[model samples]
Target: MELVFCLLFGGPSMVGALLELSKNSKDHVATSTAFTFFRLLEPHVYFLYSQYRFDKGDIGRLFIAGLGSSMLLGIIVGSLADKQV
Candidate 1:
């Protein structure tokens, strides 16, 4: 459970950190907020369902989905940055 939370949150933060390094200061706040809101919310929604005793695999699936979404978003951002530069 904790590992799920860590991955969902940590992976995005690492992505955000990389984005921050690449983007100008003016863009960091918007980018960070956008990442945090979407990335962290998924596991939490799964956690709420788990409170009702949903199977562990269901929660794992949610974590995986969130991680995949973040990775896709990161790729899009990277590609856009490449275009900009």
Candidate 2:
């Protein structure tokens, strides 16, 4: 069951990460920063799920929170980039 869950999420995650890295190949700093951020974020998320006993409600909350955070980060970064230019 855990293996099934891993395959379901891990495959897409690996592909997505590869594509992102490929897209940023010309920017070493961006690539490294992204990798480092994800490396730190993944463990914290996993720990939160494990601590919560992997409840369905908690998972849903986590998903929503992830989306919100990503959206907020995108907005902040876009604004910063605009300011820089």
Candidate 3:
């Protein structure tokens, strides 16, 4: 498959950070493919979400900030979650 060949020809850095984090996972190729697929879709998904979520304000600000923006309120809880772990 294309993913297998990519892994074969490329270095670990080209594949991504997910592979580095999942070093003990049984299937490196599958982990890379999943992370790669998510990376491709994440930006588009955020763009679409900004359209509806911030209909009047500066959508670009939210898009640029991604998840860390206080608009989502997740950042507040993220601090708590990080402390627990």
* Best candidate (score: lDDT): 1
Question: What's the CA RMSD of model 2 in angstroms?
Answer: 10.2
Clashes of 1: 0
Q: How much is the lDDT of residue 26 in candidate 1?
A: 73
Candidate ranking (TM-score, best to worst): 1, 2, 3
Which residue runs does candidate 3 get wrong by more than 4 Å?
1-31, 46-57, 70-85
**Candidate 1, residues 1-85: lDDT per residue as tens digits?**
9999989999999998897789876764456777889989977887798898988897788778889999999999999999999
CA deviation > 4 Å runs, candidate 2: 1-52
Ranked candidates (lDDT, high to low): 1, 2, 3
Candidate 1 yields a Cα-based lDDT of 0.87
TM-scores of the models, in the order given:
0.39, 0.38, 0.30
TM-score of 1: 0.39
